[model samples]
Target: MTDSSAPADPRPRSALPLLVAILALIVAGGALWVSYGNATKLAASKEHAAVAPPSDPAIEQIKETLSSLQQAVRGIQADQQRQAERVGDVQQGISIGCDPTEGLSTTGRAKVALGSTERAQHAG
Candidate 1:
């Protein structure tokens, strides 16, 4: 008599369809992830291009203004030096009765005033 309680084929043909379906799902999911990732990168690059301003014109304007200010400062310094030299010459030549302390105080006060005005103008 045949033994009826024997096990069926361990490699069941029924498993093939299940495996194909799982593979298809995995492929679809991967395709979606790649598309979304590319689209996100494209969007970020577009936004960056839109927001960043060109630097050339702004840089040139800054350089021009700096040059003008530097020229003005040099001119003023030359004038101040000339005036100080004249004062020194007068101090050496004129031995008048004017208090030496008063002359020095006046010179110091003038220098302080000039410096403050220059600073205030630059701060503006």
Candidate 2:
């Protein structure tokens, strides 16, 4: 009882194009991530290389001399401090005994004066 003009059933479409698009997006994202990481590493290495080397040998010598000069200045400052402390100690301990006849009796002073006069007379 089928007629010759009956309608045909619809066929299902393949999802291959959608799957391919998803795969392409994943590949692109992975490539982008790898490129970004490589760029960062290259930039860091360049910066380190740029800073690690001196342009001239004279610059290195000058840096060494400058450090030695700083050390010498520190040593001189320490020596000066020690000298100042020594001077302070000497000043604190000092006393004067100006009288030549100190710790002598009056008779001893007279005898010394007489002896000096006798020596002066003999020399003249």
Candidate 3:
């Protein structure tokens, strides 16, 4: 048996395997980091694509058509308003009769009275 009191041998331990393992871990970590970055980029691109407006010409044309239809509807509504105003003016002047003391002559009043009498007779 060797004597326990002898000074321990001073030979340095081989650090090669430990260094290699640490290097491998670092390389693996770097690879994982790169993969994560790439995944993030891909996800962002997908999200952007999902939110992006339509690029198709047909879709654009449909949008334009809808806008034109809305403008046409507004135009039609304006036309209806003008026609309604004209009808109101005509009704006020002729059917309901305007101020009798103004432009209307006696013969016109007699005719209006006859027309009203006829309408009342028809209703009853």
Every model's TM-score = 0.39, 0.42, 0.47
10-113 in candidate 2: lDDT tens per residue?
A: 56577998999999999999999999999999999999988866568898899999999999999999999986875555445444424434444797568656
Q: Please, what are the lDDT tens digits per residue for candidate 3 over residues 28-122?
A: 99999999999999999999988978699998999999999999999999999986875566467766666432444687568657877999999
TM-score of 2: 0.42
- Top candidate on lDDT is 3
lDDT of 1 by residue, 2-92 (tens): 5677656655478889999999999999999999999999999999989977779889999999999999999999999987986775566
Residue 56 error, candidate 1, Å: 6.9
- Per-candidate Cα lDDT values, in order, are 0.80, 0.78, 0.81
The order of the candidates by lDDT, greatest first, is 3, 1, 2
User: Which regions of candidate 2 fall more than 4 Å away from where they truly are?
Assistant: 1-51, 95-124
Cα RMSD to the true fold for all candidates: 12.4, 12.3, 7.7
Name the weakest run of 10 consecutive residues (lDDT summed) in model 2. 94-103
Residue 72 local lDDT, model 1: 100
